[model samples]
Target: MQAVAIMKQARISPQKARLVADQVRDLPVGRALEILRFSNKKAAQLIKNVLESAIANAEHNEGADIDE
Candidate 1:
């Protein structure tokens, strides 16, 4: 099963989001959320929303086990 979620035309720069994304690279979902939650950057908040949406989509549409 597969699912896709996308956020478009966000009012943030790719460079700024990349900084936060790099920190979460290759990390688990829980750990990434923790990092994003504590981050005080605009880009972090945006990226966090996207990540959460992806998780939800995987769970609802794909019936995937998020804790695997």
Candidate 2:
């Protein structure tokens, strides 16, 4: 199953958020969270929150395993 979460009209610009998003693309969820956790950019926290919500949706709603 697949689920999506979106955040609109964020205080940060798209370009800035995209920079952080790009870093996590094609990475495993665990690795992505690790990178975001220690990231220096302000956008990292925002992206991390959104990513965590997405992961929760996938796990609780879709019954997907984190290691999947």
Candidate 3:
């Protein structure tokens, strides 16, 4: 799964973005969602959106379903 964090009209440094993105990389769907949900960082929301998209893609393309 891929998690993308986008900064728009914000003064976030690229290094910080990369660091946050790295934290979410290769994490399982559930844990990643939890991290994004409770995180106070703005980047976390962007990452969460990307992660949700990835999860949806996995469900549609890979036939992997996340247990709700």
* Candidate 1 lDDT over residue span 1-68, tens digit each: 43467889989888988999999977888999999999999989998998899899999888899886
lDDT of each: 0.88, 0.88, 0.71
Q: Model 2, which residues run further than 4 Å from truth?
A: none
Q: What is the lDDT of candidate 1?
A: 0.88
Ten-residue region with minimum lDDT total, candidate 3: 1-10
In model 2, the worst 10-residue window by lDDT is: 1-10
Clashes of 1: 0
Q: Tens digit of lDDT per residue, candidate 2, span 1-68?
A: 45577777678988999999999988888899999999999899999989898988898888889787
lDDT of 3 by residue, 1-68 (tens): 34233336645677766777788777777887888799888778777776787667767777765674
How far residue 10's Cα lies from its native spot in candidate 2, in Å, is: 1.2
Residue-level lDDT for 19 in candidate 3 = 70
